[model samples]
Target: MPQPHGFRYEELADGAVVITHLERAAGTLRGPRAQQFLAEVVTGDPQLVMARWTGNYKRGNERTARNHPRNRH
Candidate 1:
């Protein structure tokens, strides 16, 4: 485990799923600081993550679903 961690020290576990996905890409990350920071955050929690998740964020189908007519079955 990393000593003196600071990522989620006081935050609620609301966005853990998002965080978990990012850690898997640390190796390809271009910045040393970012990679190191992510490592510190995910060290203790296997389920925790830090994903980039930007490829289709704006055009994803899930977002459109919410705004669609709810009456459709």
Candidate 2:
């Protein structure tokens, strides 16, 4: 079936509907430098850090997200 613009929808036999949006293209970052930056931000408030990080991600600032140590692997 044709997928909806910008998203996908699925209906299960159990009468459940699931809709998912397409994820934006991810950006890549090199190693150690990214890890170091993540370490520096680790102590910040989780919610606030994530909000700012996501904004940067959406703006094509993959370098910031890519630098996240967890994302290295």
Candidate 3:
């Protein structure tokens, strides 16, 4: 389960930006959510994703813990 557990999709005038924990899934909005998230704007216009990124939230939390020295473990 190293992959992203959640995904955030954004639509631009010409393409989309999908931010995830593992990788970015840039592609044309030829699917459900893609169309749903970007209504009329892309209404049947088909969305195109431009880029995606993997966020290291877990690593970030670890760094935070190291700095704060939390006893979570």
- Indicate which candidate wins on TM-score: 2
Instruction: Estimate every model's Cα lDDT from 0 to 1.
Output: 0.36, 0.42, 0.42
Runs with alpha carbons beyond 4 Å of true place in candidate 3? 1-3, 16-52, 55-73
Instruction: Name the better of 1 and 2 by lDDT.
Output: 2
TM-score per prediction, in order, is 0.23, 0.27, 0.26
> What's the candidate order when arranged by decreasing TM-score?
2, 3, 1
Clashing pairs in 3: 24-52, 29-47
Task: Look at candidate 2 and give me any clashing residue pairs.
Answer: none
**Separate clash counts for every candidate:** 5, 0, 2
Model 3 misses residue 18 by how many Å? 5.0
Cα lDDT tens digits, model 1, 29-55, are 334544564566567442233322223
lDDT of 1 at 21: 27
Q: How many residue pairs clash in model 1?
A: 5
Candidate 1, residue 71: the lDDT equals 35
| Residue-by-residue lDDT tens digits, candidate 3, 1-73 | 1333444455656554343323455334535655554564343322222122232324436556666746555
